[model samples]
Target: MDFNPPPYQGTNRILGGKSVTMQDVAEAAGVSISTVSRVLDERLPPSRSKAAERVRKVAQELGYRRDIMASSLRRGGTGTIGVLVPRLSDMVMALVYEAVFRAAERHGYFAIVATSGDDPAQEQSAAESLLDRRVDGLILATSRLDDQLPAQLRQRQIPHSLILRTDGVSRSALGNDEQGGYLATRHLIDLGHRDIGLLAGPNFTSSARDRQRGYRRAMNEAGIPVREEWVCESGYGIEAGESVGYSLLTRENRPSAVFAINDDLAIGVMAAAHRVGLQLGQELSLVGYNDIPLVARLPIPLTSVHVPFDHVAALAVELLLAPTEPSDPIRRVMPTLIPRASSTPPASS
Candidate 1:
C-alpha cells in the first residue's frame, strides 16, 4: 500500500515542492529573516518602510501563508472564538452570526458557531463542546431570562459575552427590546390606531418580557387599554405567529393594528391577514420588530424596529475579548424604527 497526498494547487506550492517560507521571501527580498518576519507580520518600525514594502511584495508574489496555529501558540492564545445561537434557520440568528463571523475575521480570529435550539440543557452541552475545542472565548445568543449557563461560565472564569438575549446577570450586547417595542407601539398610536394587538414572544426570554412592557407602556401613555385577549404569547416563528394572529384577527372585535415582536411572527401575521381577507396598512396596520432584509422586499414593505445586528455583534466580540472584572456592567444597544407601507391609520370599517 502506498500513501501520498495530492499536489498543491496554485502559487501556494513553490520552491520545487516545499511551501514558500519567510526565509525564501527574505532571501529573495535581500533582507534578514527577522526583517522579513517583521515586515510580513506588520511589526516593522516606521524606519523600515522601504524594506517592509519590498518584503511584503516578495512575500505576496511567493504566496507565503503564515501558520496561524503556530502564531497563536506563541502568543498563548487559540486565536479562535466560539459562538452559540438558537438556530441558523432563524434568519435573525443567522444574520447576527454572520456579523459575528465577519467581526471575528476583522480581529484576526476564527469563529466557530453551534446551535442549541434555544434549550438550556442543549446550550450547556454545546458550550462544553466549544470549551473542549480550546476556544479563546465565547459569544452566546441563546440566553433565557433565568438561564444559569452564564453564571456557570462566570464560575469557570470563561471569557464570554451574550448577544441578542441576556439573563441580566452577564455582560450582554443586545438591542433595547423595550424601547423597540415602545417605538413600534408608539408608531401605531401616532397613526391613530387605538386598538393594537401584540404577538409577543415566549416569556422565558428577557427580550419578550421587555418588549411586552414597552407595548404596555406605550398603550397606557396613549390612554388605550391593552386588552388581555389581544396580547398573545407566541413562539419565535411564523407558525406560532400565524396561529395567534389567526385567533386574534378572526375575533368579532379584533384590534385594528398588530405589533409582532419579530419578523418571523410578522410574516405569520401577514399570512393570517391574507386568510382573514384583511389588507395590511389599510384594514389592519401591522408592525414588526427586526427589520430583516425580507421585510423591505415584501409586497407590502413591513414597518419594523431595526436592531443593528452588526453593531451588536461587534460589541459582543469586543466585550468577549476585553479583560473585564466580574462587576462589569451589561451593555445594551438601542433600536430604531423603520416605517414602511405595512403600518398606517386604521381603516374606517
Candidate 2:
C-alpha cells in the first residue's frame, strides 16, 4: 500500500490519525479536562507534581495542542490586550510597553498599542476602538485615574489597569516623586544654590504637577522660599524646555539652579544654556527626572531621578493578571534619584 502525504488538520480536512482534543488527552491521562488544561498551561502549583506529570505524558503521547484562540473565543474573549500610552516616542513610556507586551505574550495574549497624543478625546477614541475589537483587558499609561475614561471603563466593567501611573490625588508606585523632587532640589541646595528654579512640564499631567509639588516641598522643608518668578512653565517637548529654559534663564537675574520634570526637558534646558555660553554644573546646577538611556552620554552628564520601569511594568502586569475583585487598586512602585556629573553647587550659593 502506498503511504499518503500528511494531510492538513482543520474542521473538514482529514489526517491519517484523528485530531487530539482536550477530552481525548484527558481520557488518555485518566484525568479531567481541567486537569489536562492546568497541566498544559502549567497553572497548577508545584504541589500537583503527579497530576502534572500524568497530563504532560498524555499530551506528549497524543501531541495535543491547546488552541488558545478557540479557547478564548469559547470563553467570549479574543485573548488580546489593549495598551494605551501617551506616546511611543517617549522613552519611558516605550519601556513600559515593551514589558507589558512580554508579560501578555507569556499569558498567550497579544498586545495592541495605542497612543492618545496627550488628549482626553484621543484617549477615549482609542479606548473605544480597542473595546470594539474585543480585547480581553486593557493596560493604560494614559489614565488620569479619576478621569472620565476610568469612569467609563468602570461602568462597562472592563478589565483595565493603570501602569506608570495610578488614579489618585497622591502619587503612586511610579515614583517617589516627592522624594525625587526633594533629592533633586536638595542636591542643588546642598551644592550651595539657594534660589533654585523649576523648569516645569505640562501642568495638566498629574506626573508633571507632582514634580513641581516635590520641588516646593523640598524648598519649604529647607526654609528656602521658592522664587515664584524663577519657575517657568512649559509643555512636553524639547522645544518646550528650550523656550522655557531660555526665557527663564534670560528674562530675570535667572535662577542659579534649574530642575526639569524629565530628562528630555532637561536636555533641552542644557542645549539652551549652552547657546548662551553658560557652563552646566558651573554657573548653574541642573537636575532632571526619568534618567533615560541618554542621561549618562549627554555632552554634560545629567543628574536625574531613575524610575525603575521594569519593576513598575512587571507589577502592573501582575496586578492586571491577578484574579481579584474591584476592592482597591494598589499603589505599587516608586522612583529613585541618581546623581550624575551635570549638577553642582553654584558659585554664589
Candidate 3:
C-alpha cells in the first residue's frame, strides 16, 4: 500500500481548515508581525507603501481574515452599538430600529437590539447585558420622563443618546409631539369641530404630555371648551384606544371628532365607531399620529401626523457616535399633518 497525500486544491485547501491569521500572513510574506498588523489594520502610514502592498498580497493569497473582536479589544472598543426599544412588535419601534441598524452599518459599526417590553426593570436588565458584551455605545428608544436609566448611564459616563423619548437631562432625538398634536387638533377646529375628544398617551411619557398640551392650546386658542371628560389618558395601544373610544362614543353627547396620540389608538377608535353605527368622516372624524403604513390601507384612509422615523434614527446615531459633544441645541424633528378620508367637517344636525 502506497502512503501518499492528495494534491491540495486551492479552494478546498482554503476552506478546509481554521481561519488564516495575520501571523500566518506575516510569516508567508517574510515581514515582521507588527508590520503585518499595521498593514492589515490599515494603520501603516504612507511611508510603508511597498511593505503594505506586499502584506496585502500575502493576506489575500493566504485568505487571512482579521479577528475584529481581538482588534477592537486592543483599541478599547467593541465597534458595536446596543439599541434598546420598548417592543419590536410595534411598527414604529421596528422601523426606528431598522433605521438605526442600517445607519450603524453605513458608519462601519454593528448594532444589536434588545426589547424591554416597556418595563423599566426589564430595560435595566437588558442594558446591563449589553454592557457586559462591551458595546461601545447605546441608542435608547425607551426613555421615560421619570425613568432613572438615563440618569444612571450619565453617572457612569456611558456614551448614549435617547431616541423617540427623553428624560430631558441627556441628549435625545425626538419628534415634535406638541406640534403634531396642535396640527391635528387645529385641523379639526378649522373644520368646525368645536367638540373634540383627545385620546392621549400615558402621563409619564413626555411625548404624551406634550401632545396633550398642544391639544389644549389649540382648543383654548379657538375658544372651544375642552370637556374634561373627553380627554382619556391610556397606554399607547389599540386596545386602550378601543376602550376609551367606546366610553366616549357611547356617551349621550359624544364629540364630533377625536385626535388620538398615535395610529394604533386611532385604529381602535375606528373599530369603536363601526360598532356604534357611526360613519367615519361623516358622523365622526378621527386623526392619528405616527402615520404608520397600516393607516393608509384602512377602509377609510386615516388622517395622521407623520413622524420622521428615518431622520430621527439617523440623527440619534450621529449624536451617539460624535467624537465630541453634540452642539445642536434643537433636537426635535418636526412632524407634518397628512389629511385623508378619516377626517371631515362634522355632519350638521
Candidate 4:
C-alpha cells in the first residue's frame, strides 16, 4: 500500500475539521511560510505591507491560531514568564501581577507567579522552581535592597527584570516612589497640616526607603521639622498600620495628619483613628499610596498616590526581553495624587 499524504485542498479547509496551520495560510495568501510566521507574530510590530495584509486576512479567514506552545518549543523557549511577588494578599502585588499577566498576553507570552513571603531564602527557592520549569524569563516584584537573587541570576546568564523594588544594580521598572511620597506628604502640608505623622513601610525595600526620602525632602522644603517620634517603621499591611498608628495617635501632641506609605496602611490608620475617637478628614486627615480600588469606596474616601501598574508591567516585560542591556537600567513611571474626602484642612485650620 502507498503511504502518501493527501493533496493540499484550498485554504478554506475548516469544513474538513482539521486545524488550520501557518502553512495553509501561507499557501492561501501566496506567501512563504517564513513571511506568514513573521506577519502573524503578535510579539513583533504589525506590518502594513500588502503581503503581510494578505497573510493576516487569510489567517483570519482560515481560523488559524498560532500554536504558542509548539512554536515556543521549536524556538527553544517555553514562551512563559515567571513573576515573583511578596504575596498576592497585598492588593498592590495582586494589581502588579494582573497587569504583568495582561502585558505578557499582549506579547504572546504566558505568565505565572509565586509568593516569596518577603523572605530572601523563599524568594530564591521560588525563583529556582520557576527557572526549572524552563520559563523564558522572570519579572520579580520582590527584590530587596540587598537582594542577592538579581546578581545570582545575572551570573547564571538569565534574563530577568525587577519591578516595584530594586537592588539598584538590576534592570528595574517601578513608580517614582520618592515623588509619590513627596506628593502624598505635600498634599497634607498644602491642606494646612503642619504636624504630620508618617507610617513608613519597612526599610529593607528600596521603595519604602525612597518614599521616606521623598517625605523628608518635602518636610525639609517646607521648613517643617520632622520629629523622630512621628516617623514609625512598619510592615506593609493594615495590622502594622493600625499598631503603629495607635502609638502615634495616642501621643501627647499627636499629628493632625498622617501619610501612610500604602493604602493598606492608610486603612489601618483609619481603623486606629476610629478606636481613638478621631474623625477622619476633620480631626485626623489621612493619605495613602498605590490608590487601590477599595480606598475610593470607603466611608471617607482616601486620598492616595496612583501608581500606573500597567505601564510599569509593560516596561518590565520589554526590559526583560530586550536583546541588549539598556543604558538606563532603572525606569520610574510618575504617579498621580488623587485627593478625596479623607484629606482636608485640619479642624484647627
Candidate 5:
C-alpha cells in the first residue's frame, strides 16, 4: 500500500487530526499571531497589505477558522446582547425586539432573545439563563413599575438596560407614554368630543400609569371632568378592549370618542363598535397607541400614536454599553400622533 497524503485543497484540513488555530496560519504565512488575529477580526476594517493577503490565502489553505468565543473572551466581552421581552407573540413586543436586533448589529454585537410571558418568576429564570450563556449585557423589555429585577441586577453589578418600561432606577429607554397619551386624547378633544372614554391598561406598568395621568391632564385642561366609570381599567389585549368597549357603548351615556392606550385594545373596541351597529368614523371616534401596521389597513383607518422604536432601541444599546453610568438614567423618545379616518369632528360640532 502506498503511504502518501494529497496536497491541501483549501478545505478544513486538520493537522494531526486537530482543529487549525491562528498559530498554524501565522507560521504558514510567515507572520505573528497578533497580525493574524487583527486581520481575521471581522469587526475591524479589512487590510490591503501584501502580508494581509498572504495571511488570508494561508488561512484558507490551512482551513483555519476564528474562534469567536476565545476572541470575545480575550476582548473582555462576549459580543452578544441578551434581550428579554414579555412575549414575542405580541406585535409591539416583536417589533421592539426587531429594532433591538438591528441596533445590536449596528454596534457589532449579536442579540439573543427569550420570552418571559410577563411573569416575574419566568423573567428571573430567563434572565439567569442568558447570563449563564455569558452574554455581555442584557436589554429588558418586561420591566414594571414595582419590578425588583433591575435592583438585583444593579446589586450584582451586571450591565443591563431597560426598554419599553422601567422601574425608574435603572438605565432605561422608552417612548414618552404621557405625551403619546395626551396627543391621542387631545386629538379627540379637538374633534369636539367632550365625553371621551379611555381604555386604560393595567397599572402594573409605568406606561399605563403615565398614560392615565396624561389622559387626566388633557381632560382637566379642557375643563372636562373625567368620569371615573369612563376610565376603564383593562388589560393590554384585544379581548379586554372588547369587554370594556361593550360596556361603555351599551351604557346610555356613552362617550362620542374613545382613546385606547394600546393598538390591540383599539382593534377590539372597533369590533365592539361594529357589533352595536355604530358607524366608525361618523358615530365613534377612536385613537390607538403604537400605530401598528394592521390598524392602518382597517376599513376605517385608526388614528394612532407612532412610537419611534428604533430610536429607543439605539438608546438602550448605548446605555448598556456606556463606559460610565450616564447622569440621565432614563431616556424617553417622543412619539407623533397619526390622524386617520377613525377620528373626526362630532356631528354636533
Candidate 6:
C-alpha cells in the first residue's frame, strides 16, 4: 500500500525532460528499439499483441516518440522516389506524373517531383539534384532517345525507369503513338477526304516523328499523295498549331482534312478555321491525337485518339522497382480513336 507505483516519479511527465526514450522503454520491455518501434507503429508480430500494447502504453507513459528521419537514415534509404518531367502543365505529363505518385505511394515510397522544361541540360541538373537527395530510385520522362542521359545514368548507378520518351538504357513505357496517328488520319480518309494535311510537332521528338510517319503511311496505303506543302512542321503546343493552321488554311489549295499531332494542336487549328469563316466538321474535316480530357466538353467536340496514361505509367514504375534482367523491352499501351463532331465526309461524298 505504501508503494503506489512509485508516486509517478518519471522525469518525462511533461514530455520535455528527454529523460525516458525508446531505448529506455526497449530496455524495460526487454527488446530492441526497432522491435519497440515496430510494436508502436503496428508493424510487429501478431503473437506480441498483448506485450506490444503494453510496450506502447509504457512508451506513452515514458513520453517516447520514434524519430522517423533518423530511422530512415539508419536503414540507408530515404524511402523516396525522384520524378522528373518535361512539364507538368502538359495534359499527358500531368496524367503520367499523377500516376507515378499513386504508384510510388502504394509501395511506401514518397515521390519528389521536378520539372526540366524539356531542356537536356536542365534535365541532367534535375537528375543530379534528386541523386543528391539520396532517393532510392527515379522515374523520368524528360530524356530524349539519343540523349546522353541513359549512359550517364548508368555511370552514376541510378536505378531508374523511363517514361513516355526513352533514352534506350532501361525498362521503359510508351503509348501507341504511331497507332494513334494512323487512327486519326484513317478516320479522315474514310470520310471521303483525299486532300489531307498533317500538323506535325517538332522534328526533334520521337512523338512528332512517329505520329507524322503514321499519317504518311495512312495516306500512302490509300493512294493519296502526301503533299509536302500540306505537311506543316511546328512546335507541338497551342500557339504553334495556331500559326501553322492559319498558314495551311490560307494556302492556294486548302486541305479538305486536317490531322494534328495532339489535342492542343487540334483545338488551335479549329480556332484558326473559325477565324477564317470556315465551319469545322462541315467545310473542313479535322482530327487530332492524345484525346485530352477537355476535348469532349469543348464547344465543338474533337475527333481524336486516346492514349492510356494509366497503363503506361504503371508499367514504367513497375520496371523501376523490379528491373528484371533482360526485361521485355516491347511493352506498349494501345490507343483508341474517338469520333466526335470535328470531322465529316468531303462535299463530293
Tens-place lDDT per residue, model 4, 167-281, is 8888999999999999999999999989999999999999999999999999999999999799999999999999999999999999999999999999999999999999998
Error of 2 at 90 (Å): 1.5
Give the candidate order by descending TM-score.
4, 1, 5, 3, 2, 6
Off by over 4 Å in 1: 1-16, 24-61, 326-328
Best by TM-score: 4
Q: Rank the candidates by lDDT, best first.
A: 4, 5, 1, 3, 6, 2
Best candidate per lDDT, number?
4
lDDT for 93 in candidate 5 is 93
TM-score of each candidate?
0.88, 0.81, 0.81, 0.91, 0.83, 0.79
- The lDDT of each candidate is 0.87, 0.76, 0.86, 0.91, 0.89, 0.79
Per-residue CA lDDT of model 3 for 1-349, tens digit only, reads: 8532221111212533655665677778898776676565432243457878887888787777665566556667987999999998888899999989988876657899999987899999999999999999999999888899999998999999999888777888899888889999999999889999999979988889999999999999999989999999989988988998999999999999999999999999999999999999999999999999999999899999999998998889888877787777238999999999999998993
lDDT of 5 at 107: 68
Q: How big is the positional error of residue 158 in model 6, measured in Å on the Cα after superposition? A: 1.0
Question: Higher-lDDT candidate among 3 and 5?
Answer: 5
lDDT of 1: 0.87
Candidates 1 and 6: which is better by lDDT?
1
| lDDT of candidate 1 at residue 231, scale 0 to 100 | 92
After superposition on all CA atoms, what RMSD does each candidate show versus the true structure? 6.7, 7.1, 8.7, 5.2, 7.5, 8.1
TM-score of model 3 vs. true structure: 0.81
lDDT value for model 2: 0.76
lDDT of 1 at 263: 93
Which residue pairs clash in candidate 4?
none
Error of 6 at 328 (Å): 1.0
Cand. 4 TM to true fold: 0.91
Query: Candidates 2 and 5: which is better by TM-score?
Result: 5
Candidate 3 segments whose C-alpha is farther than 4 A from its true place? 1-71
Candidate 6 lDDT over 1-349, as tens digits, reads 3321111112344454456666788787777665665665422234457778777777876776555455445556786889899887888788888888887765556788999987889998998899898998888887676677867776777788788766555667887678778888999988889999999977766677888888988999999988999999987678888899999999889998899998888888988998899889889988988788899988889998988887787787778877454458636788899999889898778
